[model samples]
Target chain A: MRNLTEEELRVVFEKLAKFIGKDIKALVEDSNENYCFRLQKDRVYYAREVVAAAATNIARHNLASLGICVGKFTHGGRFQVHITFVTYLARLAKYKVWLKPQSEMSFLYGNNVLKGGVARMTENTPKNQQVVVFNQSEIPLGFGVSARSSLEVQQASSTDLIVLNQADVGSYLRDEDHFVGCGL
Target chain B: MDGVEVDLGSLSCADVRPIFQEETKQELEERIRRSVEFLVHGLFTLPEQSSERKSQRELPEPFSVIPRAKPIPKEKPLTKWEQFAKIRGIRKRKRDKFAWDEGRAEFRPIHGYRSINDGSNQVILPHDPSLEPGESPFDLLKEGKRKRIASNRKNQERNKRSLSKNQLPTHALRADKRSSKSLERSAKIVSISNRSLGKHEEGKKSKQKLSSTKRSLKKSIIPNGVERERTFQAVNDVLKNF
Candidate 1:
């Protein structure tokens, strides 16, 4: 594993900031442990400093993975957040959308959340803003970008798209091969 | 009595101690006062030039007794021209500040303020055989001057960019914040508000999606083992709000 370059960190932070906003700072700087972001095979991993330092000793090719794989940098250098990072995003997300019981299955199936499925959402969530998707029980299922702001969502038709699916729990099964390759 | 050695140049006196074993403090003080008076008298005796009720005395250069406060300044690095001149064994000759202007028929400054070399002062231009039918030499001169100034400005800006690039990445990033902090904050807000967290929107050029606040995130990729403490401090700050 190696340190993320400035450009890579910027992309990662920008993606993370979309959901967590300023809480991205809390992820890097924690009171319990010295956490950091490392890049291994273009995969961004959030790990403790000691773990990252120790991982450096392992042969670059031999090392399968280090810490939690938050996301991976595409060949184009764009950072795509994986479902694995949903837990942290769920906790720290500034804007969140809750799905109804009937809509949870559709969201888990990797479908865009329809307006009818959105039971509630954080107030003042702007359109195209990244938001963590949660069930009515408050368990975060995934995260996506809002197709409409909270005010606009009310005006939108029931069939209109609310949250544009970016990543969901369904990816764990669908994209299992990719996750295994990343040692997630 | 032992002879007292006093150097007026350094304004220091040596051997001012009691010459006699029975000499009183008053006698020592009296001797010092006399030495100071002698120095003052010597200063007044210097050659003087009187003009308009003011007499200017030519005081002899005083020899310094103490070492310099700071070390001698280092020699400045030579420019490319200077280096080239050195290689060619070109001894610099001081040019006269004033030069005779043939056209003006008068002595003018060689540089700056109505200088002899200033082409703008010329009224009748030397006709060029290669000139276009309607092209004025004055306009050509002005254009050339403008191009020269523009190139110089471009080079200066390039030099500044390269200088900042050579600096440490962290320092360079910090340099951006040297501007007004509130202005930067508002600029960041505008960037974010442009298109949903500043993501490049459809039908919009990539150039339009400029996000400036991303730099505020953790700059360094590797943790320096102090993040935990920072987090603890952050937690404390949050708790303090309660």
Candidate 2:
């Protein structure tokens, strides 16, 4: 990873602020030293780390400074996602559409949500907007974009597309062509 | 009066004889005819109806008036099967009754009354479980059944049907009241213990709530704030980097 100048960092943060609906620079600290780069790294960054260096100042108190932690890496970090406890808790992630229980397994395997499978959705869930898909029990299945408006999805007769399957946690266990990381 | 009839063979009409004050020839003929008819009736029915004749003879009149006879209702005998059904408390249909005895192939009484549906042969569903006392019955929907819980009244109604008519409701109620008093006395001891147990449970519930809240707070939010001041300092120190 290469460090970024203040100009490029400002631009990235500007786009991120719109997506997150908040000023994220105020939420970060400069002394944070964890890696926060995308695949092609270019950045000074802050990241959530479950572990801390023991020689650091106030290292003993770092464990109690945050909320509950669960394993984010599995098989010695060879995989970035674990098999269990994958929950979507991002406050910024908004739009959602739920599928019936019978359609959940196929949906997690990167299949498009078939007709009559939509359980419910937020009113005016606009087309082409990023939406998180959940199961009947509200467990986050993946992130997708609305292929149809919320009204059309509920009222359409033909088996038209409703959501475009993007990334899912189930894709990690079973290799699929469209397997991206958990969008949450 | 004994009518005299002098009838010798070859008597001429010109030789008319009158016994009573100058009777006409026509009157003499009627007298003679009446005399003959009386004699013939006496000969034919005189002995055959001798008992009646004797009684009538005591009466001065010639004939007597007879009284009219009344017709009696015909009685039918019950078959052996009908007797057995009656012995088992089954009876013929009456007004408002709807039960049918399939074994006997006939409509039977419902609630101990005869049925009035004389022409209906349609099958009826068992309404014993579905109906309450004195409630009118109608066709129920095939779905959405409501099941009634068994209760003392239901049991008492069953017992009342099995009981003889001599057993009155007041006697049963008095007996039940006495038994209930005894049961309540016995239950008081157990209820005292249960009341104390409920208090103990409440005490434990409050203690559990306190522990659960503390654990939830520890897992959800920051339990230590050592980096809070330093993190804010670094955010404020962002301008120094320029």
lDDT top scorer:
1
Alpha-carbon local distance difference test for all models: 0.74, 0.46
How well does each candidate superpose onto the true structure, as a TM-score? 0.45, 0.29
* Candidate 2 deviant stretches above 4 angstroms: A1-20, A23-46, A49-91, A176-184, B1-242
For model 1, what is the alpha-carbon lDDT of residue B185?
39
TM-score of 1: 0.45
> What is the C-alpha lDDT profile of model 1 across A1-184, one tens digit per residue?
6676555666677777788877777787644877777788888888878898787667666888877889998888788998898999999999999999998999989999999999999999998999999998889899998999999988999999999999998889888887874646
lDDT tens digits, residues A2-120, model 2? 22233434444443333232424433533354322211111122334332222122322232222112112222322122222224222344567788998888887778876667787
Q: Kindly state the number of residue pairs that clash in model 2.
A: 5
lDDT of candidate 1 vs native? 0.74
- Candidate 1 per-residue lDDT over residues B97-145, each given as its tens digit: 9988787699999976688777886788888999999999999988987
Winning candidate number (TM-score): 1
lDDT of 2 by residue, B5-83 (tens): 3222222112234477778889878866766665444444433435745533221233323355866654433444565
On the 0 to 100 scale, the lDDT of residue A16 in model 2 is 34
Q: In candidate 1 chain B, where is summed lDDT lowest over 10 consecutive residues?
A: B165-174
